[model samples]
Target: MLLCGLAAVVSACGEPAPRKTGGTGTARPGDRVTAASAVPVNGGVLVDLPGNAQLLVVQPRPGEFRAFNPSCPHVGSLVNPPAGGVITCPLHGSTFDPASGAVRKGPAASGLAEVAITLSGEDLVLA
Candidate 1:
Protein backbone atom coordinates (compact mmCIF):
# COMPACT_ATOMS: atom_id res chain seq x y z
CA MET A 1 0.00 0.00 0.00
CA LEU A 2 2.77 2.40 0.80
CA LEU A 3 4.54 1.78 -2.49
CA CYS A 4 1.37 2.18 -4.47
CA GLY A 5 0.57 5.50 -2.81
CA LEU A 6 4.03 6.84 -3.45
CA ALA A 7 3.92 5.85 -7.07
CA ALA A 8 0.61 7.59 -7.59
CA VAL A 9 1.89 10.82 -6.09
CA VAL A 10 5.05 10.80 -8.12
CA SER A 11 3.17 10.23 -11.36
CA ALA A 12 0.89 13.11 -10.65
CA CYS A 13 3.74 15.40 -9.70
CA GLY A 14 5.68 15.49 -13.01
CA GLU A 15 2.76 17.02 -14.89
CA PRO A 16 -0.98 17.33 -14.95
CA ALA A 17 -2.95 16.08 -17.94
CA PRO A 18 -1.63 18.29 -20.76
CA ARG A 19 -3.73 21.37 -21.27
CA LYS A 20 -3.91 23.21 -24.59
CA THR A 21 -0.43 24.63 -23.88
CA GLY A 22 1.17 24.11 -20.45
CA GLY A 23 4.11 21.73 -19.88
CA THR A 24 6.95 24.02 -18.85
CA GLY A 25 7.32 27.21 -16.82
CA THR A 26 3.93 28.16 -15.44
CA ALA A 27 2.76 31.41 -13.90
CA ARG A 28 1.61 30.74 -10.40
CA PRO A 29 0.43 33.39 -7.98
CA GLY A 30 2.97 36.11 -7.02
CA ASP A 31 4.76 36.02 -10.40
CA ARG A 32 5.26 39.04 -12.68
CA VAL A 33 6.52 39.86 -16.18
CA THR A 34 9.25 42.42 -16.97
CA ALA A 35 10.52 44.21 -20.10
CA ALA A 36 12.28 47.36 -21.35
CA SER A 37 9.19 49.41 -20.57
CA ALA A 38 9.35 51.23 -23.93
CA VAL A 39 9.20 48.57 -26.61
CA PRO A 40 6.62 48.58 -29.37
CA VAL A 41 3.32 47.15 -28.18
CA ASN A 42 2.78 45.68 -31.62
CA GLY A 43 5.54 43.12 -31.19
CA GLY A 44 4.49 42.29 -27.60
CA VAL A 45 6.94 39.80 -26.03
CA LEU A 46 8.06 36.20 -25.90
CA VAL A 47 9.20 33.95 -23.07
CA ASP A 48 11.41 30.87 -23.14
CA LEU A 49 10.47 27.56 -21.59
CA PRO A 50 12.36 24.38 -20.98
CA GLY A 51 12.57 21.72 -23.70
CA ASN A 52 12.98 24.20 -26.54
CA ALA A 53 9.52 25.49 -25.73
CA GLN A 54 8.27 29.06 -26.16
CA LEU A 55 5.10 31.04 -25.50
CA LEU A 56 3.84 34.27 -27.09
CA VAL A 57 1.84 37.07 -25.61
CA VAL A 58 -1.45 37.56 -27.43
CA GLN A 59 -3.94 39.07 -25.02
CA PRO A 60 -4.20 40.68 -21.60
CA ARG A 61 -6.83 40.19 -18.91
CA PRO A 62 -5.69 42.68 -16.33
CA GLY A 63 -4.79 40.87 -13.06
CA GLU A 64 -4.27 37.92 -15.44
CA PHE A 65 -2.98 37.38 -18.98
CA ARG A 66 -3.19 34.74 -21.73
CA ALA A 67 -0.48 32.96 -23.72
CA PHE A 68 -0.35 30.15 -26.28
CA ASN A 69 2.35 27.66 -26.99
CA PRO A 70 3.29 26.70 -30.49
CA SER A 71 2.50 23.12 -29.38
CA CYS A 72 -0.69 21.33 -28.53
CA PRO A 73 -1.21 19.12 -25.47
CA HIS A 74 -3.98 16.94 -26.84
CA VAL A 75 -1.88 14.96 -29.29
CA GLY A 76 1.58 16.49 -29.12
CA SER A 77 0.33 18.81 -31.85
CA LEU A 78 0.23 22.60 -31.93
CA VAL A 79 -2.42 24.62 -30.12
CA ASN A 80 -3.85 27.99 -31.14
CA PRO A 81 -4.51 30.85 -28.79
CA PRO A 82 -8.06 31.70 -27.85
CA ALA A 83 -10.50 33.05 -30.38
CA GLY A 84 -12.19 36.00 -28.73
CA GLY A 85 -10.18 35.20 -25.62
CA VAL A 86 -10.82 31.43 -25.54
CA ILE A 87 -7.97 28.99 -26.08
CA THR A 88 -8.62 25.79 -28.03
CA CYS A 89 -6.64 22.73 -29.01
CA PRO A 90 -6.38 22.42 -32.75
CA LEU A 91 -5.57 18.72 -32.51
CA HIS A 92 -8.58 17.50 -30.52
CA GLY A 93 -10.95 20.45 -30.58
CA SER A 94 -10.57 21.03 -26.87
CA THR A 95 -11.29 24.59 -25.81
CA PHE A 96 -10.07 26.47 -22.74
CA ASP A 97 -10.78 29.79 -21.16
CA PRO A 98 -7.49 31.69 -21.18
CA ALA A 99 -8.43 33.43 -17.98
CA SER A 100 -8.49 29.95 -16.42
CA GLY A 101 -7.17 27.37 -18.91
CA ALA A 102 -9.83 24.87 -17.87
CA VAL A 103 -11.22 22.27 -20.20
CA ARG A 104 -14.40 23.22 -22.01
CA LYS A 105 -14.85 20.02 -23.99
CA GLY A 106 -14.59 16.25 -24.15
CA PRO A 107 -11.44 14.17 -24.94
CA ALA A 108 -9.68 16.68 -22.72
CA ALA A 109 -9.96 16.62 -18.97
CA SER A 110 -7.02 18.85 -18.07
CA GLY A 111 -6.79 22.59 -18.36
CA LEU A 112 -4.15 24.38 -20.43
CA ALA A 113 -0.84 24.65 -18.62
CA GLU A 114 -0.24 28.20 -17.52
CA VAL A 115 2.57 30.10 -19.21
CA ALA A 116 4.14 32.75 -17.01
CA ILE A 117 2.47 36.16 -17.40
CA THR A 118 2.22 39.61 -15.85
CA LEU A 119 0.72 43.03 -16.54
CA SER A 120 3.41 45.68 -16.79
CA GLY A 121 1.61 48.97 -16.81
CA GLU A 122 -1.02 48.04 -19.41
CA ASP A 123 1.34 45.69 -21.25
CA LEU A 124 0.86 41.93 -21.03
CA VAL A 125 4.16 40.24 -20.41
CA LEU A 126 4.60 36.82 -22.03
CA ALA A 127 6.91 35.80 -19.21
Candidate 2:
Protein backbone atom coordinates (compact mmCIF):
# COMPACT_ATOMS: atom_id res chain seq x y z
CA MET A 1 0.00 0.00 0.00
CA LEU A 2 1.00 3.61 -0.41
CA LEU A 3 1.17 4.11 3.32
CA CYS A 4 3.57 1.23 3.77
CA GLY A 5 5.84 2.54 1.04
CA LEU A 6 5.89 6.00 2.53
CA ALA A 7 6.67 4.66 5.96
CA ALA A 8 9.54 2.61 4.63
CA VAL A 9 10.93 5.62 2.82
CA VAL A 10 10.87 7.72 5.92
CA SER A 11 12.58 5.09 8.04
CA ALA A 12 15.23 4.40 5.40
CA CYS A 13 16.02 8.07 5.02
CA GLY A 14 17.58 8.60 8.44
CA GLU A 15 17.00 8.28 12.13
CA PRO A 16 14.11 9.95 13.88
CA ALA A 17 14.98 13.30 15.36
CA PRO A 18 17.23 12.70 18.29
CA ARG A 19 15.21 11.79 21.33
CA LYS A 20 15.67 14.01 24.32
CA THR A 21 19.04 13.04 25.80
CA GLY A 22 17.57 11.20 28.77
CA GLY A 23 16.10 7.72 29.22
CA THR A 24 12.69 6.31 28.20
CA GLY A 25 9.90 8.87 28.56
CA THR A 26 12.05 11.21 30.64
CA ALA A 27 13.72 14.55 30.10
CA ARG A 28 16.11 14.31 33.02
CA PRO A 29 19.61 12.95 32.62
CA GLY A 30 20.98 9.58 33.67
CA ASP A 31 23.05 8.73 36.72
CA ARG A 32 26.75 8.07 37.05
CA VAL A 33 28.30 4.59 37.33
CA THR A 34 31.68 3.49 38.49
CA ALA A 35 33.99 2.69 35.57
CA ALA A 36 35.55 -0.21 37.39
CA SER A 37 32.14 -1.80 37.76
CA ALA A 38 31.13 -1.26 34.13
CA VAL A 39 34.03 -1.81 31.79
CA PRO A 40 35.01 -5.44 31.48
CA VAL A 41 37.72 -7.19 29.49
CA ASN A 42 35.45 -9.74 27.83
CA GLY A 43 31.77 -8.79 27.47
CA GLY A 44 29.70 -5.72 28.26
CA VAL A 45 28.00 -4.64 31.46
CA LEU A 46 24.40 -3.48 31.52
CA VAL A 47 23.63 -0.46 33.68
CA ASP A 48 20.01 0.44 34.24
CA LEU A 49 19.48 4.15 34.68
CA PRO A 50 16.68 6.39 35.77
CA GLY A 51 13.59 6.65 33.58
CA ASN A 52 14.14 3.07 32.42
CA ALA A 53 17.17 3.72 30.28
CA GLN A 54 19.34 0.67 30.02
CA LEU A 55 22.91 1.17 28.90
CA LEU A 56 25.53 -1.31 27.79
CA VAL A 57 29.07 -0.35 28.66
CA VAL A 58 31.98 -2.05 26.97
CA GLN A 59 35.73 -1.94 27.16
CA PRO A 60 36.82 -2.53 23.61
CA ARG A 61 40.46 -2.10 24.39
CA PRO A 62 42.61 -1.42 27.34
CA GLY A 63 41.84 2.02 28.80
CA GLU A 64 38.96 2.57 26.39
CA PHE A 65 35.25 2.57 27.22
CA ARG A 66 32.07 2.88 25.18
CA ALA A 67 28.40 3.23 26.07
CA PHE A 68 25.12 2.70 24.21
CA ASN A 69 21.40 2.71 24.85
CA PRO A 70 20.50 -0.95 24.76
CA SER A 71 17.29 -0.54 22.78
CA CYS A 72 16.68 -2.17 19.42
CA PRO A 73 16.36 0.24 16.54
CA HIS A 74 13.58 -1.82 15.01
CA VAL A 75 10.98 -2.00 17.77
CA GLY A 76 12.48 -0.29 20.81
CA SER A 77 12.82 -3.60 22.58
CA LEU A 78 15.51 -3.93 25.22
CA VAL A 79 18.68 -5.42 23.75
CA ASN A 80 20.80 -7.94 25.54
CA PRO A 81 24.21 -6.67 26.60
CA PRO A 82 27.16 -7.95 24.64
CA ALA A 83 28.59 -11.34 25.27
CA GLY A 84 32.06 -11.54 23.77
CA GLY A 85 31.36 -8.13 22.21
CA VAL A 86 28.09 -8.97 20.41
CA ILE A 87 24.85 -7.24 21.43
CA THR A 88 21.64 -9.01 20.46
CA CYS A 89 18.01 -8.02 20.62
CA PRO A 90 16.01 -10.96 21.90
CA LEU A 91 12.68 -9.68 20.67
CA HIS A 92 14.03 -10.08 17.18
CA GLY A 93 17.41 -11.10 15.84
CA SER A 94 18.99 -7.71 15.31
CA THR A 95 22.53 -7.49 16.50
CA PHE A 96 24.87 -4.59 17.29
CA ASP A 97 28.40 -3.89 18.30
CA PRO A 98 28.63 -2.33 21.70
CA ALA A 99 31.95 -0.57 21.09
CA SER A 100 30.78 1.56 18.16
CA GLY A 101 27.00 1.20 18.40
CA ALA A 102 27.11 -0.14 14.86
CA VAL A 103 24.59 -2.53 13.41
CA ARG A 104 26.00 -5.96 12.94
CA LYS A 105 22.84 -7.39 11.33
CA GLY A 106 19.50 -6.27 10.03
CA PRO A 107 15.77 -6.29 10.65
CA ALA A 108 17.36 -3.32 12.33
CA ALA A 109 18.43 -0.89 9.64
CA SER A 110 20.61 1.18 11.97
CA GLY A 111 23.02 0.90 14.83
CA LEU A 112 22.32 1.06 18.51
CA ALA A 113 21.92 4.54 19.94
CA GLU A 114 24.85 6.05 21.77
CA VAL A 115 24.48 7.44 25.27
CA ALA A 116 26.64 10.32 26.40
CA ILE A 117 29.28 9.33 28.89
CA THR A 118 32.23 11.05 30.48
CA LEU A 119 34.94 9.85 32.78
CA SER A 120 35.57 11.49 36.12
CA GLY A 121 38.29 9.96 38.20
CA GLU A 122 37.24 6.31 38.33
CA ASP A 123 33.61 6.87 37.44
CA LEU A 124 31.62 7.20 34.23
CA VAL A 125 28.86 9.77 34.31
CA LEU A 126 25.88 9.59 31.99
CA ALA A 127 25.74 13.06 30.52
Candidate 3:
Protein backbone atom coordinates (compact mmCIF):
# COMPACT_ATOMS: atom_id res chain seq x y z
CA MET A 1 0.00 0.00 0.00
CA LEU A 2 2.81 2.35 0.86
CA LEU A 3 4.50 1.40 -2.37
CA CYS A 4 1.40 2.20 -4.30
CA GLY A 5 1.18 5.64 -2.73
CA LEU A 6 4.82 6.24 -3.43
CA ALA A 7 4.40 5.13 -7.01
CA ALA A 8 1.52 7.48 -7.51
CA VAL A 9 3.55 10.38 -6.23
CA VAL A 10 6.54 9.48 -8.34
CA SER A 11 4.47 9.12 -11.46
CA ALA A 12 2.83 12.47 -10.88
CA CYS A 13 6.24 14.10 -10.70
CA GLY A 14 6.54 13.79 -14.45
CA GLU A 15 3.21 15.43 -15.14
CA PRO A 16 2.57 19.10 -14.93
CA ALA A 17 1.27 19.99 -11.51
CA PRO A 18 -1.95 21.96 -11.55
CA ARG A 19 -0.98 25.56 -12.06
CA LYS A 20 -1.84 27.89 -9.21
CA THR A 21 -4.24 30.49 -10.49
CA GLY A 22 -3.59 34.00 -9.30
CA GLY A 23 -7.20 35.06 -9.17
CA THR A 24 -8.85 34.99 -5.79
CA GLY A 25 -12.22 33.82 -7.06
CA THR A 26 -13.27 30.24 -6.54
CA ALA A 27 -13.19 27.99 -9.55
CA ARG A 28 -16.30 28.38 -11.60
CA PRO A 29 -18.27 25.95 -13.63
CA GLY A 30 -16.71 25.30 -17.05
CA ASP A 31 -13.20 26.00 -15.84
CA ARG A 32 -10.69 23.50 -17.10
CA VAL A 33 -9.09 21.50 -14.30
CA THR A 34 -6.86 18.86 -15.80
CA ALA A 35 -6.65 16.37 -18.60
CA ALA A 36 -8.80 13.32 -18.02
CA SER A 37 -5.90 11.04 -18.73
CA ALA A 38 -4.03 12.45 -15.76
CA VAL A 39 -6.39 10.56 -13.48
CA PRO A 40 -5.61 6.89 -13.56
CA VAL A 41 -8.24 4.24 -13.80
CA ASN A 42 -9.50 3.43 -10.29
CA GLY A 43 -7.15 6.01 -8.87
CA GLY A 44 -7.01 9.80 -8.43
CA VAL A 45 -5.02 13.00 -8.65
CA LEU A 46 -5.02 16.15 -6.60
CA VAL A 47 -5.78 19.43 -8.39
CA ASP A 48 -5.18 22.90 -7.15
CA LEU A 49 -7.91 25.45 -7.63
CA PRO A 50 -7.88 29.22 -7.56
CA GLY A 51 -8.96 30.13 -4.07
CA ASN A 52 -6.36 27.98 -2.37
CA ALA A 53 -8.81 25.15 -2.80
CA GLN A 54 -8.12 21.64 -3.98
CA LEU A 55 -9.97 18.76 -5.54
CA LEU A 56 -9.35 15.05 -5.56
CA VAL A 57 -10.39 13.79 -8.96
CA VAL A 58 -10.91 10.06 -9.07
CA GLN A 59 -11.69 7.66 -11.83
CA PRO A 60 -13.48 4.71 -10.31
CA ARG A 61 -13.84 3.11 -13.73
CA PRO A 62 -12.89 3.82 -17.26
CA GLY A 63 -14.94 6.63 -18.79
CA GLU A 64 -16.35 7.67 -15.41
CA PHE A 65 -14.95 10.25 -13.04
CA ARG A 66 -15.77 11.82 -9.69
CA ALA A 67 -14.41 14.79 -7.84
CA PHE A 68 -14.23 15.66 -4.16
CA ASN A 69 -13.04 18.54 -2.08
CA PRO A 70 -10.48 16.20 -0.46
CA SER A 71 -10.66 18.06 2.81
CA CYS A 72 -11.22 15.90 5.85
CA PRO A 73 -14.39 17.12 7.55
CA HIS A 74 -12.90 16.55 11.00
CA VAL A 75 -10.38 19.38 11.02
CA GLY A 76 -9.92 20.41 7.37
CA SER A 77 -6.80 18.40 6.71
CA LEU A 78 -6.16 17.31 3.14
CA VAL A 79 -6.92 13.66 2.58
CA ASN A 80 -4.71 11.39 0.53
CA PRO A 81 -5.80 10.09 -2.84
CA PRO A 82 -7.63 6.82 -3.12
CA ALA A 83 -5.52 3.74 -2.48
CA GLY A 84 -6.81 0.22 -2.02
CA GLY A 85 -10.27 1.60 -2.78
CA VAL A 86 -10.27 4.15 0.05
CA ILE A 87 -9.48 7.84 0.32
CA THR A 88 -7.81 8.44 3.67
CA CYS A 89 -6.87 11.42 5.73
CA PRO A 90 -3.32 11.27 6.97
CA LEU A 91 -4.03 13.60 9.86
CA HIS A 92 -6.83 11.80 11.67
CA GLY A 93 -7.47 8.48 9.95
CA SER A 94 -10.71 9.50 8.31
CA THR A 95 -11.59 7.26 5.41
CA PHE A 96 -13.97 8.00 2.54
CA ASP A 97 -15.32 6.04 -0.36
CA PRO A 98 -13.52 6.76 -3.61
CA ALA A 99 -16.52 6.66 -5.86
CA SER A 100 -19.08 8.42 -3.69
CA GLY A 101 -16.97 10.34 -1.20
CA ALA A 102 -19.10 8.87 1.56
CA VAL A 103 -17.66 8.31 4.96
CA ARG A 104 -16.31 4.82 5.27
CA LYS A 105 -14.69 5.42 8.68
CA GLY A 106 -14.02 8.53 10.56
CA PRO A 107 -13.57 10.69 13.56
CA ALA A 108 -15.39 12.78 10.94
CA ALA A 109 -19.15 12.82 11.13
CA SER A 110 -19.47 13.97 7.53
CA GLY A 111 -18.12 12.89 4.17
CA LEU A 112 -15.93 14.72 1.70
CA ALA A 113 -17.77 17.33 -0.34
CA GLU A 114 -18.49 16.25 -3.90
CA VAL A 115 -17.44 18.56 -6.70
CA ALA A 116 -19.07 18.21 -10.07
CA ILE A 117 -16.92 17.74 -13.16
CA THR A 118 -17.45 16.90 -16.78
CA LEU A 119 -15.13 15.42 -19.34
CA SER A 120 -14.64 17.66 -22.37
CA GLY A 121 -12.83 15.63 -24.95
CA GLU A 122 -9.57 14.95 -23.10
CA ASP A 123 -10.06 17.64 -20.48
CA LEU A 124 -11.86 17.46 -17.18
CA VAL A 125 -13.81 20.62 -16.72
CA LEU A 126 -15.44 21.82 -13.53
CA ALA A 127 -19.19 21.57 -13.63
Candidate 4:
Protein backbone atom coordinates (compact mmCIF):
# COMPACT_ATOMS: atom_id res chain seq x y z
CA MET A 1 0.00 0.00 0.00
CA LEU A 2 2.75 2.40 0.96
CA LEU A 3 4.79 1.40 -2.08
CA CYS A 4 1.86 2.08 -4.34
CA GLY A 5 1.55 5.57 -2.95
CA LEU A 6 5.25 6.19 -3.45
CA ALA A 7 5.04 4.89 -6.98
CA ALA A 8 2.18 7.23 -7.67
CA VAL A 9 4.20 10.13 -6.32
CA VAL A 10 7.20 9.24 -8.48
CA SER A 11 5.08 8.86 -11.56
CA ALA A 12 2.99 11.99 -11.02
CA CYS A 13 6.02 14.18 -10.40
CA GLY A 14 7.71 13.05 -13.58
CA GLU A 15 8.68 16.00 -15.75
CA PRO A 16 11.43 16.21 -18.33
CA ALA A 17 14.67 17.66 -17.10
CA PRO A 18 16.61 20.10 -19.29
CA ARG A 19 19.08 18.51 -21.64
CA LYS A 20 22.21 20.00 -23.17
CA THR A 21 21.93 21.59 -26.58
CA GLY A 22 22.14 19.15 -29.55
CA GLY A 23 20.78 15.62 -29.16
CA THR A 24 20.00 12.96 -31.72
CA GLY A 25 17.59 10.18 -32.71
CA THR A 26 15.35 9.60 -29.63
CA ALA A 27 14.75 11.38 -26.34
CA ARG A 28 14.54 9.89 -22.84
CA PRO A 29 12.19 10.05 -19.89
CA GLY A 30 12.56 13.21 -17.87
CA ASP A 31 14.24 14.69 -20.95
CA ARG A 32 13.07 17.90 -22.54
CA VAL A 33 13.00 17.41 -26.29
CA THR A 34 13.92 20.50 -28.24
CA ALA A 35 13.17 21.65 -31.78
CA ALA A 36 15.98 19.65 -33.30
CA SER A 37 14.78 16.13 -34.06
CA ALA A 38 11.40 14.82 -32.96
CA VAL A 39 10.29 18.04 -31.31
CA PRO A 40 8.80 20.74 -33.51
CA VAL A 41 9.49 24.43 -33.75
CA ASN A 42 7.29 25.72 -36.55
CA GLY A 43 4.40 23.36 -35.84
CA GLY A 44 3.44 21.03 -33.01
CA VAL A 45 5.29 17.69 -32.93
CA LEU A 46 6.88 15.08 -30.68
CA VAL A 47 6.78 15.44 -26.89
CA ASP A 48 8.61 13.70 -24.05
CA LEU A 49 7.34 10.40 -22.59
CA PRO A 50 8.11 8.18 -19.62
CA GLY A 51 10.74 5.37 -19.34
CA ASN A 52 13.46 7.37 -21.07
CA ALA A 53 12.27 6.79 -24.61
CA GLN A 54 11.00 8.93 -27.45
CA LEU A 55 7.23 9.12 -27.68
CA LEU A 56 5.99 8.17 -31.12
CA VAL A 57 3.48 10.56 -32.69
CA VAL A 58 -0.02 9.31 -33.31
CA GLN A 59 -3.06 11.18 -34.55
CA PRO A 60 -5.97 8.81 -34.32
CA ARG A 61 -8.61 11.40 -35.05
CA PRO A 62 -8.64 14.87 -36.52
CA GLY A 63 -7.57 17.71 -34.25
CA GLU A 64 -6.22 15.26 -31.68
CA PHE A 65 -2.58 14.20 -31.52
CA ARG A 66 -1.29 11.68 -29.01
CA ALA A 67 2.31 11.01 -27.98
CA PHE A 68 3.58 7.71 -26.59
CA ASN A 69 7.01 6.35 -25.86
CA PRO A 70 7.82 3.27 -27.92
CA SER A 71 9.62 1.65 -25.02
CA CYS A 72 7.92 -0.68 -22.59
CA PRO A 73 8.23 0.24 -18.94
CA HIS A 74 8.66 -3.43 -18.01
CA VAL A 75 11.96 -3.69 -19.80
CA GLY A 76 14.05 -1.10 -21.65
CA SER A 77 12.76 -2.41 -24.99
CA LEU A 78 10.68 -0.57 -27.55
CA VAL A 79 6.90 -0.96 -27.79
CA ASN A 80 4.72 -1.08 -30.89
CA PRO A 81 1.48 0.87 -31.05
CA PRO A 82 -1.54 -1.05 -32.31
CA ALA A 83 -4.21 0.55 -34.46
CA GLY A 84 -6.86 0.15 -31.80
CA GLY A 85 -4.87 2.20 -29.25
CA VAL A 86 -2.57 -0.16 -27.40
CA ILE A 87 1.23 -0.25 -27.30
CA THR A 88 2.96 -3.63 -27.29
CA CYS A 89 6.61 -4.15 -26.56
CA PRO A 90 8.41 -6.37 -29.02
CA LEU A 91 10.79 -7.75 -26.44
CA HIS A 92 8.56 -8.82 -23.57
CA GLY A 93 5.24 -8.39 -25.31
CA SER A 94 3.91 -6.08 -22.64
CA THR A 95 0.91 -4.02 -23.63
CA PHE A 96 -0.02 -0.45 -22.70
CA ASP A 97 -2.84 1.85 -23.61
CA PRO A 98 -1.86 4.82 -25.78
CA ALA A 99 -4.48 7.06 -24.23
CA SER A 100 -3.50 6.37 -20.62
CA GLY A 101 -0.13 4.64 -20.95
CA ALA A 102 -1.31 1.94 -18.60
CA VAL A 103 0.13 -1.55 -18.50
CA ARG A 104 -2.40 -4.15 -19.60
CA LYS A 105 -0.05 -7.14 -19.37
CA GLY A 106 1.81 -9.01 -16.72
CA PRO A 107 5.45 -8.51 -15.62
CA ALA A 108 4.81 -4.83 -16.18
CA ALA A 109 1.84 -4.69 -13.85
CA SER A 110 2.39 -1.01 -13.14
CA GLY A 111 0.89 1.56 -15.43
CA LEU A 112 3.18 3.44 -17.77
CA ALA A 113 3.77 6.99 -16.61
CA GLU A 114 2.50 9.46 -19.17
CA VAL A 115 3.98 12.85 -19.92
CA ALA A 116 1.75 15.86 -20.22
CA ILE A 117 1.88 18.33 -23.11
CA THR A 118 -0.87 20.85 -23.61
CA LEU A 119 -1.47 23.12 -26.58
CA SER A 120 -1.79 26.51 -25.01
CA GLY A 121 -2.56 29.20 -27.57
CA GLU A 122 -0.66 27.71 -30.51
CA ASP A 123 2.22 26.71 -28.27
CA LEU A 124 2.82 23.20 -26.96
CA VAL A 125 3.74 23.56 -23.34
CA LEU A 126 5.61 20.37 -22.27
CA ALA A 127 6.51 21.74 -18.90
Which candidate comes out best when scored by lDDT? 3
Question: Which parts of model 3 are misplaced by more than 4 Å?
Answer: 1-25
Residue range 30-125, candidate 1, lDDT tens digits: 434444342222232345544444564444443334555545456656556456655566777877655556778747767656665556665545
Best by TM-score: 3
TM-score of 1: 0.48
lDDT of 4 at 48: 46
Candidate 2: clashing pairs of residues: none
Taking all chains together, the TM-score of candidate 3 against the true structure is 0.79
Preferred candidate (lDDT higher): 3 or 4: 3
Over the stretch 8-31, how does candidate 2's per-residue lDDT look in tens digits? 998898966444222433423445
- Give lDDT for model 2: 0.72
* 20-63: candidate 3 lDDT, tens digit per residue: 42221388999988899899998999887777667899999998
Higher-ranked by TM-score: 1 or 3 = 3
TM-score: the better of candidates 2 and 4: 2
* Candidate 4 lDDT tens digits, 60-112: 44445445545556766655545455566678778776556678886786755
Candidate 2 Cα deviation (angstroms), residue 12:
47
Clashing pairs in 4: 17-30, 29-52, 70-79
Q: In angstroms, how far off is 35's CA in candidate 4?
A: 11
RMSD per model, one decimal: 11.2, 11.6, 11.0, 14.4
